[model samples]
Target: MKRFDEIDEHNYSSDLIDEMFKLITPEAQAKTHYRMGLAAKIDDALKAKGWKNQDLAKALNIKSSSLVSKWLSGTHNFTVDTLVLIQMALGIQLLDVGEEDKPNATSPDNGNTPNAPVELAKNIDAIKQSLTSVANSNQKSFATINYK
Candidate 1:
């Protein structure tokens, strides 16, 4: 007979356990989501500035750009210090609580602001175009970026 330590605890297949382990806990998952969102914002900012990963790494004072890549990968856990450093380097906000969670903020006019989403979408589209233009122009731009 196999000892308890030698047997699978929950009778789950090894592959299944491996897959489950690949995913983080719910809290960490939430954090990953937040990090990914920040990464996307940073990506946009980088494009807007026409800066490369090496430029960002230099701004972060990291000798290697791999560190920046890891920070952007979303799977890496970010420390408060790292986040602050990124914010300082990029001059951007990474974790501001927006109007959605504001205690006094409302949708205005009995939640009848139906155009707000459209406006936001339009603004996002504009920003995308701006970034693309910067990228296409091959301009050596630099701006604030944050990893936190």
Candidate 2:
């Protein structure tokens, strides 16, 4: 149970640090997943308590329905303070990001696995190409439309 701060930085290998960075840098995405799981738990609790979104919003002191809507939609990038508020409001812990639940928990695919990094890179490149194609198409569509 070594804390991140307790890690021996002087002895740290670049490869090890890079792997750690890959795991830690995706925290926003991990938090999004955790929030979604928490939301599902809260929805279940609300159903049991016969409470609605407005009720939870009122408890949280959030005025707008849109605020709650954004939270439920998982599109909002919540700050640490806001996450604490939501935890208090919902009475459930939402900090677990399912890192242990990864399919390749023993060895990550980012050059840590035998052939997984190659496959991962190929998949990522394909996704990037698809996204770029979609973006280019959208840009062309926008350019052709004259908004005078």
| TM-score for each model | 0.48, 0.41
lDDT (tens digit, per residue) of candidate 1 on 43-97: 7777778888899998877899988787778676778788777777777766545
- Give me the runs in candidate 2 sitting further than 4 Å from their true place: 1-35, 96-148
Model 2 TM-score on a 0 to 1 scale? 0.41
Taken over the whole model, the C-alpha lDDT of each candidate is: 0.67, 0.67
- Candidate 2 lDDT over 1-148, as tens digits, reads 5788998978866788687767853445445645565566667666777878888789888787667777776566678787787677767655545654444322334235432444556778999999999999999999999888
- Give the range of the ten consecutive residues with the poorest summed lDDT in model 1: 103-112
The candidate that wins on TM-score is 1
Poorest stretch of ten by lDDT in candidate 2 = 102-111
- Cα miss at 87, model 1 (Å)? 1.3
